[model samples]
Target: MLMHSVSGVLIILVLIATGYWLTVQGWFDEHYSKITSKLVTQIALPCYMINTITTQFTRGHLLKILPDLQFPILSMTLLFGLSYLVQWFFQIDPHHRGLFKSMFANSNTVFVGLPVNMALFGKASIPYVLVYYMANTTFFWTLGVYLIRSDGQTHPGFNLWQIVQKIFSPPLLGFMMGIVLVCLQIKLPPFVESDLHYLGNLTIPLSMFFIGMKLAQMGLRNIRPSKDMAGIFLGRFLLAPILMTILVLPLTVPNLMKAVFIIQSAMPVMTNAPVVAKLYHADSNYAAVMVTATTCFSLIMVPLLMMMVMRLV
Candidate 1:
């Protein structure tokens, strides 16, 4: 299991490296990233998540893992409070505070994290991954959105319908529907199911390609960690994972789910950080740089952490 898991992480790193090289070679640019981002967010990811929930998730699985949601909720809630306190103590800039809080609290759970979980724990791990997915998604859209907006960038502000739309996003709807279907035990026809399985498989490679394109846009030479950046790194690569793992120790859930939660919690910053930052008029460049740094670090940390988690269970 360790060897296979490590190999998966290595393969993902290679993809990042290849994407970097492609950018240098002029094969990827801003346009490529823009298109890929749309594809992943609107199509591939929703398909991947919907397929996973419908096919792999069951009432039994949900019943068993439901209690485990608090791990991420508590860990993120603690880190968020700590992040805010630290930012306040150090007097972080108003523009960047929200980005910093998000960097610490919410992870790239659905996109990059899901792929890694697929690699390490396989199809069966999706239900467990969804635990983090649900929690992180909740924090991300609500508190995460608020932090970005709180940077005091003028947004159109919130409308009740808009908030509802954001909360019940396509992926979340896919997840909820999957639960409904699962509880009723309705299976799709074999051919249709096979097609969803195939279409959903496109998410991993597409997501990695999008990351590579973003790396190209940012340029590797430009990535230099500042004091705040250092804090962000610790919150993401080191503190968040360690804290999540420790919190999971006493959980009565399946051993593999515990490990899955730890690894998912440790995933790099969300790929959408820059976009969200830009929307809220925050420091988009800082978001991009942090995303690059933490992602590179995770190539090593995620696999190593998984190996340790395998021992703990």
Candidate 2:
């Protein structure tokens, strides 16, 4: 277990180190990183998510989640509170609290979630995870956006259309199209599914490399890890998932579902947290620290936590 954890951590660190070196060496510019993140978010993530959702939301699949949504929601909400609690305890400025809230609730669902799942469970678990992420996307963009508006900033005025816009955003639209395909009972020819499988698999490494690129852009020099930052790291990487695992694993969740939920929770703070922080004039630095520390730490924490969960189950 320890070895597995160490290997996972080392791989991620090496990727980051390589990325850092490449940027320092001027192999890629910030424009390159932006394009990479854009491709992942606008193209790769949506396609993979749509492919998974189409398969899972089929005739019999949609109604089967009666009890399943509970744990995910509970876990998400719990982590949300814990993250906010940290901000309050730390006495982070009112401005930064929103960023802290995002760190607690958002997670690295793509880069870390995909690779870790394939390593710990298998390709079969990917569809279930896609659903979880699809749902998470909605919550993160909507409620998360709302939280960051502060100091009498004109609230973007609650807009359901905006939420729908997020859902219909390229990545999510793919998932929606998948659902339509499933409902229409149109199976992709074997060749297409095969193509999807091949393309979808690229999600893992590409996303990881994107993380590497972001870390390179931030680098160690730009980020000074503060105690408040450390708290967000611990909360996301260690504490929140640990709390979720205890609640979800003991329930009758299938081993695969349990693994997905637990591992997803274990992912690093969501990249959007910082974006939202910057948007609302919150503590973007704190959000950046949360991103860096959690990204660095989750390499070890995720695998070790997975091993423990597997053993307990």
Candidate 3:
């Protein structure tokens, strides 16, 4: 298990490093990164969701998974509330407070968490991963985005339509579409399924490339130790995983599900954080730094975490 975890994270790191190397070589830029992000989020992820959900899960499996959503939802809620106290203690700058809180509570469930879980636990872990993804996506889109936006210059009033649209993003819609098909017993034609599989294959590589692009743009030299950075590190690597273990230790769910949830909880900051920060005129550079820091740290944490999880579960 330890070797598997190390190798899994090493593979992801190599891909990210490849992207970093390419970007440094002028093979890709910010514009290319944006395109890659769009390709993954808009095109690849939805197809991947449909392909994975339809093939790996049945209606009964999804039904069983739905009840497990409570674990991640509750864990993130607690993390969000805890962020307030951390903010007060750390005296985080008012402008970056929202970004801090959102990053503190959310994880890169798709980009980092999914791949790590898949690599360590194999395809059987997909459904558990999606369960956590469902909760993480909902939290980030609604409360998380709102928090980041609040840090901006203009505080826009809440629009139900806007929140709804953000929550029902393309990837999520694809997940729902898959569920509907499963419930209805509908199967796609062979060619369509094959095409979806092909498109879905782009998600992991493109996501890694996007991360590398951002890391290259930010430059590791820019990261400095500070109260905010420490708070986020504590939240992502320590508080989140500990909270998840406490929540799942007594649950009757499969041990694999418990392990997946714990791993997902400890993933890096959301890749969307910096993008949203840029859009809202918040501290995007700060968000990017945290994302880079946590991602790099996670390579060290994954093997240790798998060892701990093996004992607990």
Candidate 4:
């Protein structure tokens, strides 16, 4: 059936409405969303990563993917370069350059990527998905931040410790601890393992629901479409994913992994792009508009792209 795309669209629309209702009712505002994002980044996401990876990280398993990590890193780097080139070629406002670069920057690996992949590809793909996230987030905090702030008189600084601190976050720390235990061949007692599973399972749904809540807070009126925004829309939601498909198809990736990869590639610009823009003095409004347009268009574009990738794979 041609329903994978349909299903994805339907699910996102439902989430959009849920977000809209929440915002209209004043249930989710910036303060609330910040708190929720904290929970996701601080606790739930890490717990899920730890629990999921620990159970799967055998020595042999790690060995299998020793080379596959490069695909995601390469994919992300390519996307970043593509974004920069597009911004330069278009002569986009110098102020908007940072956001423009970031628009196609990070993949929505957590919110949209994991659930869809899990549903379609099962639990086996989770570790690979997480590995992809490690690369994306690493680039986002370091290179991403610097690029967005290029206008400052002083040169950009890399706070290695701060970046490391982000990596060693509670959730991330837990994940690392889990990996260590697996490498050391220490098994958790059955009850403790079960508890981990219980807490970890809460992650995906909460993240998705929070994405819905964010949409509500942002409101549809804020999403009023404009032709000025089309370049970003076309570049991110269309061109970037297609570029991914072309680049990846010849790489000898598994069909299913390829499907997951392309869908991740095709996702709307990250919600965090605007956040990065604001923090770095980029054109936050342009970033927001790009985010809005790509996201709304994803209701149409992502599913179709997924379907095409699925067939090719």
Candidate 5:
């Protein structure tokens, strides 16, 4: 598990570096990033969610998934709330406050979490990955989106209609559809399923490419971690995982599922946090720095934590 976790993160690092090189050599540009954004947000991610769910759905898997999501979602939502509460005693600005809490709460589950579990536990890990995915996705589109949008002067606070729209995003919609199909044990047509899965395969590399482009757009100078960003680093890498381990204490799932859930919980901030930060007039450079720094550091932190988990579990 430890070795596989290390190898998994290394693979992601290589992809990120590849994208960085592409950006440096002018193979990608603003237009390329925009296109990649649209592709993942609208197409690839949705398909990916559906493919993962349908491919791995089984009676046993389905029974465990919904019940298992409770702890991670509740714990993360609380951590997000606790982060916001922490800001009250300090003099943090509105923009940085929201960015910090959002980064602390969400994880790069689809990219880092999924692959890490696969590497550590092999194909059976998909179902456990989905548990975290469903929980993280729910947190992200709701409170997570609200955090980014809070910086926009024109954006209103906590509108139900907006929440409805956010929750019904392409990826969430696809995931929901997958739940329907799987619960009913209804399979898609073989031809369509094959194509959807093929499209889904584009998500990981494309997401990394998008991140690299954002880093390029922000310039390498912006990657420096600030003191505030370091606080978020501790929150994400240390506090979040500890919280998850505590949260999972009462759940009687397999050791592997518990390990994967906590590991996924401890992942770096969501890749799209900066993208939404930019969209919603927040401190995007700050968000980008959080993403990059945590991502690079997690190469070391995640494997170490997995080793710890292996010993205890």
Candidate 6:
């Protein structure tokens, strides 16, 4: 199990290294990174969601997984509350307090979490991953976005419509559409399924490439030790996974679900944080540093966490 876990993470790291090397070679720039991100998020990921959900899960499986969503929802809610206490204790910057809270509570479920889970647990882990993704997405769009926006110079009033649109992202829509088809017993034509399978294959590699490009763009110069960075690191790598283990360990769900949920909980900060911060005139650089730092830390954490999960679950 230890060897398997290490090998799985090594595979992901190699892909990430490839992206970093390519970026260093000037094969990819910021514009190419943006295009790659769009391709994965808008096109590849949704197709992956639909294809994985329809093929791997049945109506009964969906029903069973739906209730497990509460674990991630509750864990994140508790983390959000914990963020306030951390801010008060650590005297986190007032200007970016909202960004701090958002990052503290949310994880990059799709980009980092999805590929890591797939590497560790294979295709069987997709449904459990989606369960956590649904909760994480809903929380990030509603409360998380609101918090980040509050850090901006222009504090716009809450916009329900905008929140709805962001929450129903393409990948999420694909998951929902898959659920509908499963419940209705509908199947796509063979050609469409085949096409989706091919496109879906792009998700993991493209996601890794994007991560590498972002890391190359940001570089190590941006990372500096500070109370805020420490707080986020504690929240993401330690508290988050511990909290998830507490929630799911005693449950009767499959051990794979428990392991996947724990791994997802411990993922890096949301990749979207920097974008949202820049949009709202908050500390986008801080957000980027957090993303890069946690992502680097996760490469170390994944193997250890997988070993821990093997023993615990």
Candidate number achieving the greatest TM-score relative to the actual structure: 5
TM for every model, in the order presented, reads 0.79, 0.74, 0.85, 0.73, 0.89, 0.78
RMSD, every candidate, angstroms: 3.5, 4.3, 2.9, 4.4, 2.4, 3.6
Clashing pairs in 5: none
Q: How do the residues 89-168 of candidate 2 rate in per-residue lDDT, one tens digit apiece?
A: 88876666666676677777655676677666667877667656765665675556556544225454647875465335
Off by over 4 Å in 3: 114-126, 149-153, 251-253, 275-284
The TM-score that candidate 6 achieves is 0.78
lDDT of 3 by residue, 81-188 (tens): 999999999999999988999999999887778777877778888888989987997788668877887888565565888667656767778877888999998999
**Candidate 2's C-alpha lDDT?**
0.65
lDDT of 4 by residue, 227-313 (tens): 336657766667766776776788776777667767776676665555444444555446555655666677677556656766864
By lDDT, the candidates rank as: 3, 6, 5, 1, 2, 4
lDDT of 3 at 128: 88
What is the Cα-based lDDT of residue 25 in candidate 3?
A: 94
TM-score for model 5?
A: 0.89
TM-score-superior candidate, 1 or 2: 1
Q: Which stretches of candidate 6 lie over 4 Å from their true place?
A: 91-99, 108-130, 140-155, 249-260, 270-288
Q: Write the per-residue lDDT of candidate 6 for residues 173-292, one digit (tens) a residue.
A: 887787788989899999999999999989878776766776678775667888999999889999999999998898777899889989989988987676556545666567767876
Error of 2 at 128 (Å): 5.0
Cα lDDT tens digits for candidate 1, 1-313: 5555555455655776777788789887766766665666556656666687776677787778778788889989988988987777667677788888988788888666776777776887887788888788768756776676567455647788866765665555666666777778898888977777887777766666655666667666778767777778778877888798788777676788888888888888876666555544566567767776777777678767777777755
Give model 1's clash tally: 0
Name the weakest run of 10 consecutive residues (lDDT summed) in model 5: 84-93
**Whole-model lDDT, candidate 4?**
0.63
For candidate 6, which ten residues in a row score worst on lDDT? Answer: 1-10
Candidate number that wins on TM-score, 1 or 6 = 1
The positional error of residue 122 in candidate 5, measured at the CA in angstroms, is 3.5
Which residue pairs of candidate 6 clash?
Answer: none
Task: Report how far residue 184 has shifted in candidate 4, in Å.
Answer: 3.0
Ranking by TM-score: 5, 3, 1, 6, 2, 4
Better of 4 and 6 by TM-score: 6
What Cα-based lDDT does every candidate model obtain? 0.73, 0.65, 0.82, 0.63, 0.77, 0.80
